[model samples]
Target: MRKLGLGLAAAALCAAVPVMAQETAPAFDAEAATQAYMATLSGAARAKSDAYFEGGYWLILWGAVVSIVTNLIFLRLGWSARLSAWAGRRTQRPFLRSLLWAAPYILIISLMTLPWSWYQEYYREHQYGLSNQSFGAWFSEGTMGLAISIVVMSLLIGGLLALVRRYRENWWGIGAAATLVFVAILLMVAPVSIAPLFNKYSPMEAGPLREQILSMARANTVPADNVYVVDQSRQTTRISANVSGLGPTIRISLNDNLLNQGTPAEVRAVMGHELGHYVLNHSFSLLLGFGVIILLAYLSVAKLVPVLLRKWGGRWGVTEVTDPAAVPAAFIVLAVYFMLATPFTNSLTRMHEQEADVFGLAAARAPDGFAKVAMKLSTYRKIEPSTWEEIIFFDHPSGHTRVSTAMKWKAENIGAADIE
Candidate 1:
């Protein structure tokens, strides 16, 4: 009887083990834990947090509306179709017709948006206590941005023209792939060169926080030469850091606000999250995924455009597609396509951010830190979103999701030691 009882007890123990392990896993609840901590703090912390989000949410909404409305108005005006028709019909050189049609929309629409875009950026930022940059600074930045946009858009339109002229129906995928590569190249280079134009960067000053951050990087096998801190305080009060560049070009960078104001744990937490982005190849994944989307979407447009042109071109007074006036129509169509596709893109992006959140918690050993950061970012990022809101608009994990994960992690690893 005793021997039989022992055997049964061993079997029971074995059966319970797996369930126990699952229950005790060190998952993150950084979000909840931090909010709980925030709940404990006084008035100033809460106010600062609230102030952080002032312009971000509304601005994004307004910007999207403006983008769509502006494009729609242009399209409805038959501007592009008219311009393109005039150019295509008048130009003796067929080769130059599309370029001529595209040129006007490129110049005018950009000019149209410049004043409002600049004001929205400058005023909204100042209103939120997020920026200290002077008008000259803002203007200079805007000018550079406009220059880059023109270059990139020209390249993009030129490539699209190539596909439309030759492959026609099959061009969308190729064009999308081209866009991905172009963007990737831009990302890989911009951080090292273009970003420096606006702000000064220097090695992180000697400090315990710097030492600890470096230690974490080493432990993670991140080959960073030295950490850089930028004078982002010249522009904004918000704090951030990034691990930008690839291979030899890789730079581990943080803003002056991060160094000056953020707590050591907070800095570490955010850096860990950015490092998570690098370690996980989030950029690459996004680049490729976005490429696929562009390819597929453009293909759908390709399919739809020809039919629509055949159906409505005669009525709209446009003959061939290479019309300047049709540029507005095409852009509007593309905008609609992208707007409808937002849910899928947002979902994919959220997943990537969540993955980075996990990696950050592990790497920083500071789940609580990320949770607190969420409270801060809530000023700009949504703290919580309904499922539908998350699906349609957010391209990153909502603060609630981030904090909850952090809290869950804390709950599981309650005994884990805080960073030194």
Candidate 2:
């Protein structure tokens, strides 16, 4: 009877072991976890990042002012008129004349804005320790970009000017449609043709990481057979990845910075976010949204340009909406429209990005990884911001928002096998 009692007690103790262990396990506190993740990015690093990001708010205003002033200078000085006249002397064809006018107009504007561009893009980037390129490399890339812009913008402007001449009153609607089509074509072609001009792209080497990314792509119905890595480290240390292009042109790519800086889980988290963009059809949705905005801009320009031309046409040497010289005036209105629309545009993009974050958290199942990467991004992005500042300026979620999201997800899924 003594031996039996002892055995029974031992069984009872064994049965209670798991229950006791479970009871003692601490519940995940999402808010605490979020604060802990944010704490990692303190001191001078955090201040620098905040300063850099905050400075961009002023840049947006200054950039628009510069652009508007530049266009005004061209018009007031009759530079645009002289250039258009020169192009007319060379060609009788309206489209050819427009193209000729565009080449010199773009070149002159670029030259005029070089100082501001250099300060904003080169000096400011270096000041913030965000750039990796030398002045020569940066200038070379800028020149290439200038040439591409001249060609593309010239073609687009020429087409629109032709429509303006033909359609007269209805040109705005048609021009808007044409611009959307041009944007779509650029989207399809840029990844293959234009991006390679700046960076070399290669297949991600065969390995567990590559296989894992491909596996995620497959799981998400992303039509990618392989992953490509871009040599973005040559330009900046920023980590990034994307599933770019439309339909048949779609490419899955990550910059070398991501590969170098990110752990496997971090890579997975980033890739999953990018894949979410594709799966959620963000590109198409954005196009549709922006198309509406573009239509409104064009409509406003249509009404405003003619009125301005009538009042200032003689002084500006621009007589008609169809005149190549009038392009600057039209774009001045466009610049202002877009500048004012910045908050709305940023919000639209931010909403999509947040949705992607949610999708990535589920797909990658790497909440901690996601949180860590958000901290890494704090090297450039402000990790926290006031609510209104985020709504107005940020196109991506603040790091604090991302980390908090990940913590919340982890809290809910604490008992999952893969979660720690």
Candidate 3:
């Protein structure tokens, strides 16, 4: 979602794709292997994980519906019109007007969605033994997130409005470039500026693991001097590590969950996968991929909004894309687009993840480690989703795919003296 245009609306999920290699692979029994992994979970854990992941499928459907419906309601109630007129009356400056208009618009939408957010992020998490946060702490973070969203959306909207006013006939091209630049800047600043809002990041304690992580970063040309540990146990038990930022801001960070819950081999495997993201330049590739998606979304809006307005513009008191009041209706279109594009976008992410798996195997030389970590991930993710579900819903490899890849790697290189 951080990479997606709507910023917070998109769900960050995971999936799998098969990997190809020169070595003849072992014919691992995927179904039996998946069954073995599922057997590892307790009856309660299995039910809960199944319920949580499966419930997520429904959440996706409902989230899109809610987003479109919410925006439509705002337009129908004339809230967008009233807010736009108020901002117009108060500000003569274009940027200031856009900022003024965006503040309330974003706040209204956030407030409207608070109930769902609470249920999804807070209540459900606690119910599942995943959350370590108190309600107050969760609320505080949510508030901070909302504030940041307001500032970001305001700036982005101001720029977009200026572009639209300046190049009404062909703003899509210019708008796409600007959108790319904005996202680039956001990624650059995120590690240093934005990430600290919710969690404290301290240099990881001096130890072999830190040294190992730094070495991986060095080998990968990641430009990171230290491994930072984010205090994520304060919120959830999902284990993770990431190579975030780019260029001068490049940094490697791992969540506390990974340190506490993962074995040393699992740690290396996960770190390898994270490092693979940076080493393989998946971030920029993903940015470029999502950028294209965003471009198409913007172009679709540009092409369709005029026609839509012709049909219902008078009813909502909206004239065109230039009008600040048109934001809600435009949002409805974008949200629908986001929903429709999920499978395509998700496939792109899954492919990148599979490549990372291949790279992780080579980099960490910990095939068993990778396999165990993949099973561990099954604590939250459905390890054996149907093929179509995996294609449509996941952004990272499923456990069966990952474990099989690791098994194949082991089969090919079982007696290698040195993986390092």
Residues 325-349, candidate 3, lDDT per residue (tens digit)? 8877778888889889989898999
lDDT of 1 by residue, 1-420 (tens): 443454556557778555545344334345545567556434765455444444454555566566666765565567766766677677876446666666566776777777667768787677666788899988888878777776667666766776676775577777787777777788778777788887897887777888888888788777657468889888888877876765566677898887777778888998888778877877778777888788777777777766666776666655555444444546656766776777788888888888888888888877667877876676666565688877766777777777788777766666656732
Off by over 4 Å in 3: 1-38, 224-226
lDDT of 1: 0.71
TM-score of each: 0.80, 0.93, 0.90
lDDT of 2 by residue, 324-374 (tens): 999999889988898899899999999999999999998899999899999
Q: Can you rank all candidates by TM-score, best first?
A: 2, 3, 1
lDDT of 2 at 110: 92
**Better structure of 1 and 2 per TM-score:** 2
Clashing pairs in 2: none
Task: Return the number of clashes found in candidate 1.
Answer: 26
Model 2 score (lDDT):
0.89
Q: Candidates 1 and 2: which is better by lDDT?
A: 2
